[model samples]
Target: MNSNQKKLVKSTVPVLQTNGTDLTKHFYSRMFKHHPELKNLFNMSNQASGKQQHALAGAVLAYAEHIENPEVLINVLKSIGNKHVSLNISPEQYDIVGHHLISSIKEVLGEAASDDLIEAWTEAYNELAQIMISIEAELYQSNLKKEGGWKGWRTFIISEITEESSEVKSFYLKPKDQASIADYLPGQYLSVKLFIPALGHEQARQYSLSSAFNPEYYRISVKKESNGNVPEGVVSNMLHHKKTGDEIWVSAPSGVFHAGVESNQPLVLISGGIGITPLLSMLETNKKRLQENTTVWLHSCRNEKVHAFKDNVDRLNQDSEWLTTHVFYETLSQNGNDSVKEGRINLAELRDEVLIDDAKYYICGPEVFIKVQYDSLIKLGVAQEDILYEEFGPQLLHFN
Candidate 1:
């Protein structure tokens, strides 16, 4: 964009800072009204909780704040673009979104939406859209060229459903066409799409692969998210209700959060609650290569009843001395349980066990858990580059 357009975009930063969420909320409502079919592609649960709106609002504010140097937003754009590829977002839809977004800006601003301002925003939106399209095109091509990968959604048959815990269930999925499955990185996730009867539309949710990569099948363990007060999880509840011999749609695994399999650095895996999914994959993948300086897994959950994959961790421990594990339960049913600690996994308390020199740490959990662990690690003198974290939803963390 030209200098005048940049100035126009920058001038809206104040308005966006104060009214971004309202604008995005209105934008989504208007866009969905005109393009109802797109409902199938969105996570209705996030929409209901207003997380999606909050995420988009943050993105808009970030864009306006960095309008003069858009390259500064490259990481954010790459993260979003990878997700878009997993969702099979097409280029044509960009036009629809741009039209609605600009229209929403006009509608929200009312008389303040001058022609010059709208024109500048139009150019800015087009530029961002093109960047996304180019990035997604490259991602699609790369995934398509992989040996067992395909673009868009592929049919998968659930061959088995193993109840792992009171709240989590593991589904063993095999390609219905009997095609070989792609080998995904240990920390990667796959998008699963299914029809929600209540919503009368399909909804897609990303679930981390919970086990090591297998050529024959892929495994995803889902924690049912119904806690009475919170809205019922459409996809998680549906997956829990499903039985053997059921079918679902799955996209190729895609995620930037991953452990370096070839690196010999000491690995620290910290997880809380249901966040253990992807970290479990990384641990399982490294099981065979465990040495004295292998991987360490520190996990925390509500109690033994909700703890998943205990047997798997035990069996892995028996195989090699490389996998060291420490389990913490917030509310243990038995006080004398020798195997588990009765408290949250506090990094400060376990500084000796963790904080190894030259260790690469991977954490996954709720926002609070991630922030706590990240801050603790930083306080313990760990480099920011050495700490990797994965959030279930949008990329909201901005590291300095």
Candidate 2:
């Protein structure tokens, strides 16, 4: 904020740009060394894969790039806030992160990290921390304002578990209190926290609300990760282990990936694999509301066996004349023919088959998939404002 801080930020940009990955690697190693307990706070597999480390470095560099104007970082801050909320990252953890972050910077920069530089980074970290804390606090407050919302986590008894596919299962959850739950907007997500004895404390994950918001209950479809890494998505595997009447902790619904129910424009929802959860909710809600003019749903999966909610999607399509649904399976069945296609969804297919000229597009999927779709949409002449996307990681969908 001050002249010295501004200078430091500007100088740090080059260093960050050049050695961002190295700095992040060192940062985490040092952090874990000092506070081994905090290791559980991060995804170890993500660290091993270098995705989380690179993401953190990229975020730090981006913050520095926009240090002179904090407003430019609003989208980044919001995304981080959502992720933190999903992780159940506490305000207290921010202090721990900040302390280690500064130390890491100094350790990496060595003599070049002067007193003024340290002070500047410290101030910047404090500023970023304050912004995140305030945003998360607001999110928490909003969740609590809703009727079924509660602070921290609340016990939700699993009423039923239906296997949607070999890898995916849908869990029907109801608050143990028996009171009416707050209705969430279609495409929103709920943060589920799990207390793993092996991992210690609690770990959290976010899953999109797969069913239309009803006062009675909520539904989430989770696909078990078979790679056997990252603690198996703590919350998701926990749900898999649950059965009828099992109690689980769930936070209030929160997310910005909801549909524009108020808009009259055409809506195109594109998804891949487990990403169908949110889009399914939007489609179901639209069918119920009869707001189905010019709506298109495109989903991609590997095969019929792993494709979830097929029956529900088929039923919705058969029942709602206003909605059009398309499923693309990469692998062919015994009939030796694929339903729609036999490969990944690309811009060519999207532009040719899915996207409408004047439609508002909502895309959710893996990071690479979303990026490709986004670039294709733009290349196809769709305005930036017309495309909405949500990534699981801390990346800004819209920078401008």
Candidate 3:
């Protein structure tokens, strides 16, 4: 974009900061009204909860904030691209979104949206959309080129379901056609699209693959999110009701949040609550490598009943001297295991295990859990580059 166009976009940063969520909420309502069929591609639960709106608002604000150097937003855009690829977002749909977004800006701004102002935003959105489309195109191609890979969705049968915890269940899915499934990194996630009879439209949710990669099947551990802390999870409840031999639509595994298998650095895996799903997969994969340096896992949950994979981690801990673990429960855990501690995680308490030389830290959990860990690490002098995280659900994917 030209200097004038860039200035126009940047000038809207203040407006975006204050009214971004409302703008995106308006955009969604307008878009859905014009094209109801697109409803199948979004998570209506997030729509209802306003998480999706908040996320888009944040994205737009970030774009305008960094309009002068859009490349700096590449990481954020790549994260969104991963989600877009999972949903089979098409290039043609960008035009539809662009039209609605520009229209929303015009309609909401009223007299403030002069012809020049509209032209500038139009250019800015076009530029941003091109970058997004390119990123998604590369992601689609990567998935397509993988062994046993295909674009869009495929039918998978629920071969097995086991309750991992009081609130969490594991579902082992095998291709109904008996075809090979694409191999994925241990921390990657796959999208599950299912028909919600109540909504009268299909809804999709991304669940982290809970086990190490296997050619025969893919597994996802889902937590029933009915705790009233967040929006009630419609898909999680429906998934819990599933039976063996049930079929659901699943897309190829996609995500940017994965452990670097090529790295030999000592690994630190931290999780809170249901965030353990992907980290558990990472833990399992790390166990197989048997790296020379010790591996540490720190997990926090409300209590033993809701603590998933407790035994599995314990077994791995017992079997490998290279592995160490720490568990924290808000409520007392009567398992009488030395690994269990009462209270939330404190990095200061376990400094020796986590502050290893050149250790790579991978964290997954709620926003607060991640931010606390990140801040703790920084205070303890750990480099920011070494701390990586995967935010759950449709929210700001980046940590401040």
Candidate 4:
């Protein structure tokens, strides 16, 4: 874009900071109204909860503020590109989104929206969209290059369903074509699409691959969301009701949360509640890879009733001496509760034992859980680059 176009995008930063969500909300409203088929590609639950809008708003504001040097936003844009590729979003769809977004800006800004400003934004949006399209194309090619992987969605059969806890179940997915499956990083996830009958359209959700990568199958442990009214747990509930041999559309595994296996530093996997999914994969994969990294798992849950994968962790530890497990039960108020401690997982108190020199920390769980642990670790003198966490939903998890 030219200097004038860049200036036009920069000038909109203030308005975006103030009314970005409103603009994205209007964009989605108009997009879905005109193209109802697009609903199948979005998580309606997130749409209803306003998380999708808020996330898009943050993204827009960031892009506008950094319009002068969009190259600096490559990392953030790549993450979004990963999601878009997982959903099999096509390049042609960008034009539709751009139209609705430009129209939304005009409708929201009213008389202030001049022809020149609109023209500038049109060029600006196209530039970003092209960058995104290129990123997604590269991602698709990367996945396709892996044996047993392809672009877009593939049908997978639920071969086995194992009950892990009162609220969570493990679904073993295998490609219906009976072909080998590509290996994913321990902390990666795959998008699973299911049809929501009540909504009269399909919905997709990303679930962490709970086990180590293998050729036979990919495992995703899902916690049935039991709270709230209709549509709250719609997709998960539908998944839980599905019997063995049922088929679901699945995207190739994609995520940037996993750690590098080459690092010989100590590995710490901390989790709360059902957020243990991806962390579990990390722990399991470390064993399969036979890495020399000394690993520690610090987990907190309400009680043993909701604790998943306790046996798997125990068996893995028994087979080898590479892993250590620590548990904290929230409801335990007395001794002999078969837990290491009570209340939430405390890095400060356990630092002496669980904390290792030159260790990288991986955390996953609720938003607040991640924040508390992140803040605590930082206060304990851990380097910011050594700690990483993944949020479980469509919401943007940011720390600044």
Note the clash tally of each candidate: 0, 0, 0, 0
The better candidate by TM-score, 1 or 2, is 1
lDDT of 2 by residue, 213-312 (tens): 8888899889887646645555567678888998888877878778866566787888988888898888888777777757788888898898898889
Residues 1-400 of candidate 1: C-alpha lDDT, one tens digit per residue: 9999989999999999899999999999999999999888877678888888889988988888888898998877888888898899999999999999999999999999999999999999999999999999999999989989899999999999999999999999999999888888889999999987778888889999999888999999999988343235767888899989999999999988888777788999999989999998888778644533577889999999899998898888777677788999988884457888998888988899898888999999988889999999999899998999998886667776
Candidate 1 weakest lDDT stretch, 10 residues: 226-235
**lDDT at position 347, candidate 1:** 92
Q: Sort by lDDT, best first.
A: 3, 1, 4, 2
* Clash count, predicted structure 3: 0
What TM-score would candidate 2 get against the native?
0.92
Write down the TM-score for model 1: 0.96
Off-target runs (Cα >4 Å) in candidate 3 are 227-231, 290-293, 333-336
TM-score of 4: 0.95
Ranking by TM-score: 3, 1, 4, 2
* Model 4 ranges off by over 4 Å: 333-336
Estimate every model's Cα lDDT from 0 to 1.
Answer: 0.89, 0.80, 0.89, 0.88
The candidate with the higher TM-score, 1 or 4, is 1
